[model samples]
Target chain A: MEEGTASKRAAGRFCSICTQRKPALRRPKTLEQICRECFYAVFEEEIHNVIIKNHLFKAGERIAVGASGGKDSTVLAYVLSELNRRHGYGLDLFLLSVDEGITGYRDDSLETVKRNEIQYGLPLKIVSYMDLYGWTMDEIVKVIGLKNNCTFCGVFRRQALDRGAAFLKADKLVTGHNADDIAETVLLNILRGDIARLSRCAYIMTGEDGPIPRCKPFKYTYEKEIDKYAYFKKLDYFSTECIYSPNAYRGFAREFIKDLERIRPQAILDIIRSGENFRISTTTRMPEQGICERCGYISSQKLCKACVLLEGLNRGLPKLGISRIKAGNDGSGRPDEEPTRRGREVERPILESKPCGTLDF
Target chain B: MHLTLEFGGGLDLLCQSVKIHQVDVAPKDENAKLTMRDLLAWVRSSLIKERPEMFMKGDTVRPGVLVLVNDCDWELCGGIDMELEEKDVVVFISTLHGG
Candidate 1:
């Protein structure tokens, strides 16, 4: 128990990458023991390589980072800015956040994002649900209750991010969706039989057809490495969960991925690869993309999910688009009602039931 | 043995929101040396006030929780069987939390 004895006893093996400094962590992807400096070097380098390999950005492109002030985005903002300068990527980086207006939860985290703006010296733009949909998550929860509020938030936040990026005139939006998150979505999409999402969930970049395409720079980075990098670098990021999302079904998938990772560290990337290689049948019925009749956002139905949900809330029937078609269809009887109902039945459970924290879009 | 215990990435919420603790923990067996396996049980019983499941699964820290001893990953030193020493700083961080 003496100081000398403790020093001798606790001196861990040297870094396999550097072989001089003590190893700080074991990389889950490569299973290599590396020191803090080597870990940082390899971690940042891998993400940079992913960016270059995927052609994620171009010179002078205005890129907006989907910053949630959490470990992933905080690290994303920091590293993206660092890499933009280090590699001379010639990208104009901005921090973009969607405020769901969950009062204490989001308000507190937004402070971290504000600090991040200063810490990383990036211009920050935040779009709130109240501004766009005239409803905060708290108000939506008050009307719709906990049963399906996440649906409204997820749909609204997705659009909110796009609108915010568009307002910033950003050509591309980058998110902090790591390998674990992508893997969880792959599993969830497979479990729910959402073929369209399952097919594209593993892609490093998505929504190429949309106005502002989104990319996942950390698509292959492990969450464990991000957390350790933030901790060792003393980066500021929020850590609290959204108070309303206590029992999200995505928790099951997240836990399953973590368990798989415990047995085989390669499982995370393997699941993503499996999702990528899956080919949907040509005969399969795919949702056709069109503009929403109410708003110009892309949608498969006449009205987008957000417009339908907002109409329900505005009409004082918050459950209008949520519940299944029963005998008692409230007599509003709009002409486009049938397709919206069918769309809700197909998409709501899979997308809305996801944890709000992990809504990458 | 005297040691420092630090929790972050929302794991501290389970332990009354105290991020750091300095305490003395002795091996249950007089003849055997203390290891991380023993320290985890000690922390679970003494520090974790609620939601023990969030902090542990089976006899080890939960799958997404990273363990570091003296600034080095416990994985480098044999994981749960890694021996502990006086004044060693052990940190547990949960990566399963939001973002």
Candidate 2:
């Protein structure tokens, strides 16, 4: 090792875990200073352990990774492929991306996903908003403005990913939602009193009862580690704020999480643990899940949020799906009934204060 | 001293969207050696063009920003107090962006 001076060289610290090479990073989960090689070993092995312990995958299964060309998903795609090959998991992996049709933001990131498809040699399926919803985010933003555009994007993107997975005929779907993302969702859900999502947000795997089972292998992985891994490995991923995302509310919660992480990195995992342990009261009325009457997508309401929002957009009353109107106004107040044009002028407050994004449950 | 500074994970946005830079930085005092704390001040004044808060807070990097000196985590080198040498490579990456 090159030494500026003998004294400074003496102060060099070796890897705490390997006790050999210089430590490259301090893992947030274990707070252990590890070398680059050991970091990769432990990081991958921890994910493999999480997979095996949770039984997230089965032999000869086709799994689609919900890739956004972001750091977390990029690393997830790389690691999953590596593990499948290394351990003989006998799984077929596919990269699934949703094109929101935002001009400068998503368009740029999708290029990275395209590159990942070639780099990882995984088949890619991109489902676009224009094809599915008949409107792109750019078009929606033009009509709806920035105030509640995220609601439209969030609702649409969730269904788009599911539809893409169905088209791919993959047995399971996985997302790159990390510990920090889940912890943020937990906080947002609690703040909004969204018991349904708050109870399930901490789950590593979800949608078992739905058409496609979705899992989060990085449920406990810290975002910091993912970022560092991508940096050290020179992983090619895109990082830019969405053009349409003001996300002021979620930004506050995200900032709070970062602040707490600074104080105690363990707080991120603890918040998720607290969320997982919360038990809902039996007496509380839960929203019943049923197929949407119009679109046949899964929904708690008679019509899915997508159909409701689409109907409003088509009817030139984009707020119809989002506004809180009294129940049973138009016989069943379903999408089939034409919403009254008179009450369209009245603005109601958004009930769910949860931040709208791809990770929304 | 000449050093290489690389930014990634959206940290490049603060630096006119340039990801890498080769620059010359020296200690504030002529008789003393440079430390990470001094280099941070130099980077903030010289390189960061916008949203300084996104890069730093309270004399160190903002939470969720990872720093590496000579390709090794600065945490292993006493964080902001680590002594810097000529031709060292310093990398900063932000993990606060959406996945």
Candidate 3:
């Protein structure tokens, strides 16, 4: 059945369940027979169960939902607010948005999130990249160059979310990462052979073991479903991606996985299941968790990569500490040249006796 | 013989293209001989452009590089310690976050 394809005004397709005129795009990766409304119902049901089964939400927990004002997050807010009301989840729901200082994209998205806060009747907390990091994303990208925007966003956003959650006194932080997102991550880790991350990221409900348990209520939901839900529900969300995001490796993985999924519909799910089955023994020297000296976030080292990179950005040497942030483009300040290691509080004993009278030292 | 080298995401920028000759794998000089550790060192110095870790012959591979044999992931075996056969495909990918 070529459902809805034969309609005269193919520019707009009627969602049978919601009876809303959805813009006729190519049918989703899944079948088009399932109207946007039905997909949303299915999406919410799956999320509710994923949360309930995992005990993701705790009793009297204050939840800070990370709302980027994107479709995924906007739909997350709608579902979360609805779930709180219908099930009396007793969740103190609040919107926590990180304005990454992307000129057109983040600015527009935050506007949508603001409207969503009013519509959902949830308190909103807005954090800006400029306020927190002393540099806007655009400015950082210009200085640091195009290679590490995702690193900037991901690290900063993670810390930003935690800060916002803390400000809200949130017991739990909810993100809008869906099944597709997770599955792509699984593939990327597998491709990288990152056993530690592969092992840890397998679980649907993550983030709570350390400080504030971050949960993904939309873990089981697909991107198509999230888009459909936002469309049918008339939820406002940013349609455009962050301009810098196209070059991100995660985006590459996402595209690769999506292409593979076309060949085998179960590819995405299979990858995620593999991640679930995969386990890392404790014997492996995984990145040990340590508290950041600058910000108290758990990291592998004393000062987290975020703090080190921020120090670099602020110091006008944007490539420091981790090369992943620089993507190996340029050796901005080699450790051999600088007297101080990125996180080293004091010079090594090896260096103490050598440089008493050097003009630079 | 030729071995295809693949890299994921950010590493793709380092060696937009990489080719390690099969002869280079079995060099006469021990100093010139390449191990998985050497590759990591080269990548750390050449591609990663960061402070070189004190990498040795048998330390665990950084979670970044994925040494694949043909099309298969070495994790299916011992991982990191999986010895390289001639013309073995080596694919390096970045650690991902999600599930």
Name the best candidate (by DockQ): 1
Pairs of residues clashing in candidate 1: none
How well docked is model 3, in DockQ terms? Answer: 0.01
Using Cα atoms, each model's DockQ against the true complex is 0.67, 0.62, 0.01
- Per-model C-alpha RMSD: 6.0, 5.5, 18.1
Q: Which consecutive 10 residues in model 1 chain A have the weakest lDDT in total?
A: A350-359
lDDT of 2 by residue, A198-272 (tens): 968899888887778889999999998898888889999999878777554787888899999978999999999
After TM-score superposition, what is the CA distance of residue B86 in candidate 1 from its true location, in Å? Answer: 0.6
Checking candidate 3 for backbone clashes, the offending pairs are A201-B99, A208-A213
C-alpha positional error of residue A201 in candidate 1 after TM-score superposition, expressed in Å? 1.0
Give the alpha carbon lDDT tens digit for every residue of A1-361 in model 1. 4546534644645778878876777899889877899999999999999999999999999999999999999999999999999999999999999999898899999999999999999999998876676667887787677888777877778888888888899999999999999999999999989888886889988888778888999999999999999999999999987888876788899999999998999999999999999999899998887766545567776666776676676556778667853222232433334322323222222222221111233
Summarize candidate 1's per-residue lDDT along B54-91 as a digit string, tens digits.
99999999999999887777887779998888788999
lDDT of 3 by residue, A1-361 (tens): 1233233223344554466744222233343434434565656777788878988886698999988877777878888888878777888999999988888778977888889888889999998766666557877777666887677667777777777787799998888887778887788888888776785566765654666677777766666445545544657665544668757777677666655654565666777788889967768887766665545566666566666666665445666654645332231333433322335333232111111100000
The candidate 2 chain A region of ten consecutive residues with least summed lDDT is A348-357
> By DockQ thresholds, what CAPRI class is model 1?
medium
